[model samples]
Target: MMKTMKILTALAATMATIPAVAHEIWVERDASGPARIYLGEPAEAVPEAGDPEFHHLQKPQAIQSDDKPIAFVRRANHIEATVPGSGDVRVRDDSVFAPWKSGEKMQGAIFYARAGRSETAAKLDLELVPAAANADRFTLLFRGKPVPAAKLTVITPDRWQKAFFTDANGGVEIPKLGAGRYIVGASHTEEGPAKLGGQDVASVVHISTLTFVR
Candidate 1:
């Protein structure tokens, strides 16, 4: 009993270090017809658009029938993107809080246009893409390479969430998905160059998300 209690205490402490936001990005249509970009957790509640921590790492990219460039319109709560043709739009928030005394945090977002499925818009730190051969399978990439054994959390249209791990090639297969809209998320952390609090350190967190409608 004492050993079990000690294990439980340790687990609790470890979980405390995790952030409450667990940010994610997705695109949804607004009343004006243009797609609006959101940054937050879709599984729990509407993204905290007003969260001060939400900021673009770089200019957002959009690929549609014309391959036009789209920019993020920063609003009081959330950001918006104008997709002219509707192919794929992506945004990266690189090292949003890098050089922190604790570590660095980054985010990537991908939106698949209803017209076709394709690769990520921007190959940032991490990426989640659909498998070429199977619609139910997916591939997770870290630093533009396959990431083996990475954890993937999937949220279905009905708000059902499940966790999965990648195979040797960073591939994951979801046997059951009736499909509507789905959000796939993956995160990885490693030791990397960082300047935090005026001191050099080695720690970074990379988070990526893929949002699609079937």
Candidate 2:
């Protein structure tokens, strides 16, 4: 009975350490600091329906792009870019608190093959080079869904870049993309072509749409 009791005690101690490995935001400074929480007050706690202070807090500056869509720039997060045509773009989400961190790099790619090739879907590999460690985060949206298409990897020598159809199989040959069309676009969570609140922020190349065909 003593031996069994000892084993059970050891197991309990090991299980106690699991919570430390999970990082969490807190409101207090104690070891088990106040956990980060979202506002969920009742409607009565909100100010008057049309109060100026309340409205101002919720209003977001709208941006415009002549014929292109605005990429999202996580509000309240900071990022920089050296590309001239790039400006602070719009993130595609409208959540109260966007989860992307500042300096996260963003990119996308599209593969195209001949209309009737035996291997129409090709596999490709690309590297992303960021200016700093943890400097950028990558979010890839393909056909409107987030997939492994990104090949998540450690930051490589060529971070902050993109490539398409890079495999050695005949599937990669340009001929395989028999005269068909494809669309690909990319944007940075931190950078943009226009200054915040500027009239022309939306038209920047922050949201780049590319069309390729054989």
Candidate 3:
């Protein structure tokens, strides 16, 4: 467990830093081919924005499913790799953006992403997972425990978004918006000594997203 947590910064902790960049990282794979990791908003495109952030992905080629390594390559705007199985594919990047000032304190940010939903186990230190198979219910957990009252943003396939807070169980249910890709974005803040781009930070913000087709 200690070894896994070490690699986490090094994916995040508490309220994340997403205001400045407004960019997010996620993975996508249809019946067409390999899973592709992306850095941007779900329903919108930042136009060549992903390539620049691609360099910040320093973690080894990885996917939580099966605990095996996969080779990811930089494409025109995203990272692509062939995953091993149908299980969820998770990705984390700690150095994507430089730490920025958030109010009185300077904060660093870490981003975690999952390509598939419905996988119940918590692969990342923090994540949003389906509470049950064949249901729209979901839960936000940190290290396998509920992250209660956290703010959650749901982005629909049509570039629409709605924001709300989680219930006591760290759970929320979103009515199926449509027949396209959907992304649920949530963040938490952890205070401690951390580094962003090799610089010291007062606290680290973790931004996690769950992407899946409805």
Candidate 4:
């Protein structure tokens, strides 16, 4: 089961903009592949009327810096990113706004993930022992699309109760991604579903660096 605890708003704001300072940034799997360029927000707020990029985004001006990607992926909202220094920033809808409130400075994962090649997907099995009873629902996000539904399973502690998830594609399973390092895990949050903070006891399981192959 997952619990919702409010982190201090002051901290969240600080950790949201760490990716703006980078010399060179690009998401890479190995060598030859397409990596998205993370364009950052301006240092000082550019006038909304004068700024051409402002009106295009849901929340402009507040976008993090173009500093090298604190994390990397081909596209946005396809995978979860882990910010190394302070904390983490979860990407929800390919959004440009930071995941923090005003005045709240935070240090966590402040990177974003996006779909790359077909090789970025993988199969994962998680053993969830929640702090309390939960709805027993979670999502396996790879890049942005769900993994093969047949590959996901939720097993109860009793060893008898088991449930299988279904992909939108009738009986056919979702795509089995190619070979690459993918940040794989489960999330319940709708906005920042893959964004994880604090302890591992929460509803999400950010197990390891997932790599798929031929």
Candidate 5:
């Protein structure tokens, strides 16, 4: 209980230091193969104004559904990979963006992304886990505890978007979710004195997304 309070306090101190809404990273995948990870807004798909250069994606991991580690292939506009298993395939890049100046302090960010809504355990520091297999309702967690009243943004496959807030228990439900890929994003910032690329930083940010097709 004390640890959760400390984390929540640290988050409150740093959330305003950096704006979490910006070009985000997300993943789209099929059940057995072909996962394309993007470094920009999904509304444009790719090669659009909001999309950054695909090369900006750093060493992101393809957390598989099974015990075996799947391989990734880098392409010109996106990272391509053949993923195994029928469950959710998660991806993350701790160094997607290099440490940069946020006014006078150096700030760093870590992006966490998922490509399915199947029943999957939390693997990243921040994740949007489905309530059940292929469920639309989700729970937001920080260090494995509910994060009350956090903002969660949902982008439907048709490019419609709406932001929802988590309840006291960090739970939210996606309304009228339909076919195609959906991207759900949330972020958290921690007051930090941490190292990135051998450089120290004042705060570290975490942005997470859950993308799944109905």
Candidate 6:
């Protein structure tokens, strides 16, 4: 029992380093229709933006509106891109690498986005999206492939949180939800070390997020 407790304690500590809402990027449309990229929890009263500490990767790249290139402007807290007419707009941030601890390395801060009813893959280290329009099922991908048994945390419009895991096909079924906004997040840590933050550390933790309105 003591050994089990120790393992659980260590797991908790590791998770503490990655906040429940950190490392997630999603698109939000203002009243006028222009899309803004936000970096934190979309469910927050005022979801935070940007990751100056860990966003050592290059600026957002491959920003597009239905395959047509769109320019992105960096703001104090978030990145903004104009949506052209919206069929399936997608954007991704540069991947950043950093030392998780002594001898462990991790790369992350990757983000992907698309608007409404479209189930496209961002093809990042990890990706999340709804299965279909008004669907309660979601799919997760790792390195552009299905991530079976991946764990996820889902936040509803009212801030209710639930824990779930992907099935054999990297899919998760969520409870029937009301219309507002939602955020689903997942993460994975690998044993191999990658060069990040100018040094070599231990393992790499990859985080992904998907946000949409019903």
- Candidate achieving higher lDDT, 1 or 6: 6
Ranking by TM-score: 5, 3, 6, 1, 4, 2
Candidate 6 Cα outliers beyond 4 Å, as residue runs: 1-21, 30-32, 47-58, 63-67, 75-77, 95-98, 102-109, 113-115, 120-122, 197-202
Summarize candidate 2's per-residue lDDT along 1-214 as a digit string, tens digits. Answer: 9999999998887564332211111010112211111111211122333222222222222222444532322222111111113222221212222122122322221111111111211121111211232222222333333334322211111222234432222111122223333222333232243333323232221222222222
User: How do the predictions measure up, each by TM-score?
Assistant: 0.67, 0.18, 0.81, 0.20, 0.83, 0.68
Stretches off by above 4 angstroms in model 5 are 1-21, 48-50, 64-69
- Would you give me the overall lDDT of model 2? 0.24
What lDDT does each candidate get? 0.59, 0.24, 0.77, 0.28, 0.80, 0.62
**Could you tell me how far off, in angstroms, the CA of residue 185 lies in candidate 2 after the best superposition?**
1.7
Global lDDT of model 1:
0.59
Output the number of the TM-score-best candidate: 5
How far is 72's C-alpha from truth in model 4 (Å)?
Answer: 10
Q: Taking the tens digit of each residue's C-alpha lDDT, what string does model 1 give over 26-118?
A: 566523356665655668656344543456323344434455566667765556676665455555544334333232442222222221236
The ten-residue window of minimal lDDT in model 1 covers 107-116
In model 4, the runs with Cα more than 4 Å from the true position are 1-31, 37-95, 99-111, 114-172, 175-187, 190-214
* Model 1 regions lying over 4 Å from their true place: 1-21, 29-33, 47-68, 75-77, 103-116, 120-122, 195-201
Q: In model 3, which range of ten residues has the least summed lDDT?
A: 11-20
Every model: Cα RMSD to truth = 7.1, 20.3, 10.1, 17.0, 9.7, 6.6
Model 4 Cα lDDT, one tens digit per residue, 78-160? 22243333211222222333333323332222223222223222232211111122212223453344444534322121222
- TM-score, candidate 2, is 0.18
lDDT of 1 at 185: 76
